[model samples]
Target: MAISSAGYEGTVDEPQWSDLLANGGGRQYAVADAASWKVTAGTADREVRIAVGRGYGYGVRDVSDTVVSLTLPAPSSGSRYDLIVAHRDWQANVTTFTRIAGSSARSIPTRVQTPGTIDDQPIALVRVTAGQTQVTEIVDLRVVNGSLAFDELVLQYLNRLGTKVRIGVTEWDRDVDSVGNPVWNRTDVTPDTGWVEATRNGGWAFQYCQFRRVGAVIFYRIAAERTQGWGAGDNLAIIPAGFAPDVATYVASSSSRGQGREFVFQTNGSVDTAIASSGATNVTLIGSYVAPR
Candidate 1:
């Protein structure tokens, strides 16, 4: 027999996957099956929408003859978030994944929370039925507050499970924090040894005020060479990661590496660099803003 996220994967016949949505006066949603859900062509359960409010529900789009689509609601900004998706049937879990290649089958429920919630959480769980083109889709999506208030947004399809589909939120990098924020730049070079302290001299730009990893060892140095003609450390040494030191926030200024002289840093993982001072020449104090690789 065939199977879908709406059903179970193995001999149990049926599986039940659900979520306990904490609607901060909004709706909630979760994708049970993801394999059969297709977005490109020749599929079903193609899209999704998650709703948040006093009552939580989801909207699914049936695409092609085999694809199904759905959507869920976004949680309130700056609020605690928790979501879980699991297989409905326990017995079928094994048979559900037996035939799928490059797939992992497990009875363990997949739990997701803000990054800090758990220690090394797997992105999502997968299961496939034997001898079937089983696919799964899970989605996690959020729409920032706009003029017109809406409860939900559509998420891009992720992967497939048994005969159904799965979708989840796509991870992204975004600019945050106001300029003029003081920060210290530190590559993995020397933890507290090298330091580059800088502030928003002015300019609207996405500065990488933090880094987490950089290869085996990140090499960074905070340098301020005293210009020969300029007296008493006249020329600035390094411009912080995201600042155009010599320009106003709204005005176009010289590049961060102007005149072929600037501070250099390397990072890969979580690192923090802040705007230290409005104007300070010569001395470049560097420190570990965030952990380095």
Candidate 2:
């Protein structure tokens, strides 16, 4: 008797089990026939054995009252496969599975069952890492339609060395002396005043200056006016704290009556102006510096 490509078929009276046995493609024997197989299949236990010419094969057995195990033949170095197991008990709390490859055995997390859940699930094993884990890119920014928005994003590190640094944008007005200390007599002007020590001498009035900082660098733009007319005299402006110039020799550009002069930073963090021509009402200064932390 032979089993054809279409498979075996027979009536009850005719029978096909003998035909399957006679063909000898595979065989079923008592479990006791395999001396190395340690499983109790009871008195009626039988096992199907097949000769795999290549690749691998699996043997599953109910080992004991509380244990079931699946065995696989040893595989070659580059070979890989996926294995799946199902549990009929939905209330089981098993959250891990064991894998034995070559001489190495490891316990891996089972994905199907999570804590506080009672459901049978499927698990996927991605990759086994043996060294450092790395990622090339995490995010990309783009505009959708005509709008762009993000719920949360971190632009800077929280800590530098052991100190905390912050970044911000602000707009304010204040009056100060040569070292950047605020003078309480200043008023907030309509168009935004950036002056330090603004004062009036008889008919002439002057607005000191203003400065802004980014990181540890500071940039300043200041202006003063001779309300009635320009005059010849020295005016002083204080540099704010945290933005003082590194040296007194630092020079800033000062212009009056269409002519440019130089203002210098004094050792006390003040800027001393050059003589202003009589009737000259506009005096301005501009400069930048790297401030100390």
Candidate 3:
């Protein structure tokens, strides 16, 4: 067999079973990773397979009956990648997978650890692709015993790398007589109408959060107040003004000044208010970490 050193950059939307049948080849590579294909109506057309280069081997750390752990060395720092662990049983699903350095999971289609009955299934590990000086992401995925059978594991690297973004925030209580809904016309800040801006990044990400829908919804907790707008014996209930015409529950009346307070929405409560708004009022929000919601 001749050797070529080019990269494949096309999208692969085929099922694993069909690819396996078409290629019928898996013994020439130095590294290997399993790929799970979906089956529908007995036709396995599209497949999702892992492209592992030669000479790469599993860097296994330790393994238990239902749990296996390993160390993943990245090509560069700040790169996004994913590690998929396949279980034999569909019932045996991923229980939990936490990054060592507090990188929270952005989204998950299925539970990390779920029970399955399918044999030779594959899970995925996806992280943003980037170049950095230090490795900031380490993760562990554990499956529940007796939930599913065991199979091969797959690691997939995502295209986008995780870029660092800094943020800051400030909280204040406003009179709920009216003017609670901020406008969404553009990125420019509006007067009196709530608006937000990115402190950096050439105004890359900016979002404004507002409380709209009434009915058992907590807008925000007033931690401090320079003006007695939210001080002792204040009757301000954080009433929902603009979009929220209905009356909502507001936790007011703190015993002392500079005390700890929090707002929570009850279970099954409605938050029919927009977290953002715009108008012709001028207000300056002094804070950092202005992210787009």
Candidate 4:
């Protein structure tokens, strides 16, 4: 085997199954943190389902969901068991669902004490009462994917839910790149894109107006007054590179002493303001909007 000095795949330094998985109460990632690739109740009583998700299970990336009806042997008086995983393992080339039996009390059941193969990735707990026909309850034991050493949100490993959640985000735009593959857009250091002042237009005077970019969002502050007639599409400022939103974003303000004004972010990176024809003075807005990449 070639020794990989750069932690690349197809070598000894390839990412492990635990790399994309997180723990429920385990601290491999953090102290008493979260779980990854979570499982939930299915349509049927005996069936539990895991939404289509992705993870490295055998040092290989696997994308799948679990919808199989688990075996339910009649409990003598009821047995308490922890569902160790969706852990893709065993010589049979299957995801082994090991039930570690323990206390029968109706509460958060105990998980495996020293689970590791890179530590145990538990999905949930299962308790079946004697003569029960279905799984009593499925406690949500999953948390943000923290199998890695960094924070999940900071690392951007999310997207482990929904149908075909391999690299797709339903609510987030620009998640997929030009080739449609999911990508992490953050850098090790967030650039300090400074703000720029807005230019006066159509007799409108700028008191304070500027915008800055931090990560994938753009924040701006505005304060201005109308000294003269301000038109509908007057440009205020130019949005910095990579900070303009896919769609136009807006901020509005109006005062009885001044006039109603709206700050519109144009796709061309120009910030425009539309003053109300029948309203009064000073407009001020302080907010942030997404700059999707």
Instruction: Score residue 138 of candidate 3 by CA lDDT.
Output: 23
In what order do the candidates fall by lDDT, top score first?
Answer: 4, 2, 3, 1
Supply the TM-score for candidate 3: 0.20
Off by over 4 Å in 1: 1-68, 71-84, 91-216, 220-233, 239-293
lDDT tens readout by residue for model 1, 1-293? 22332222222221122222222112223322332221221232211222221111221111122222222222223221122221122333211111111223232333332211211111122332333332233322222211111111222121111111111112221223367433222122322324344432222132322222232232333333222212321222233453221222111112332232223222211112222222332333233233222
Better of 3 and 4 by TM-score: 4
lDDT of model number 3: 0.25
Clashes of 1: 101
lDDT of 3 by residue, 1-293 (tens): 11111112233234533333233232111112121111111112111222222111011111112222333334444454444343323243222222221123433324233222332222333343345433333232221111111221211211012211111121112122246542212121212333212122111121333432222222332222323122222222222333232334323224253222322222223321122112211111221112221
Q: Is candidate 2 or candidate 4 better by lDDT?
A: 4
Instruction: Note the Cα lDDT for every prediction shown.
Output: 0.24, 0.32, 0.25, 0.48
lDDT of 4 by residue, 1-293 (tens): 11111112333322432443332222222212223245555555445555444433223333444433455455667566445354433233333444545467543334433322322344456666666566776655443333323212212222432212111122222256688786544332246578855444545566777777765667888766765535677665666666677888776764445434666888777877755534455666678887665
Give me the candidate number with maximum lDDT.
4
lDDT of 4: 0.48
| Tens-digit per-residue lDDT, 126-166, candidate 2 | 12223212211112111111111111111111111222111
| Best of the candidates, TM-score | 4
Higher-ranked by TM-score: 1 or 3: 1
Candidate 3, backbone clash total = 59
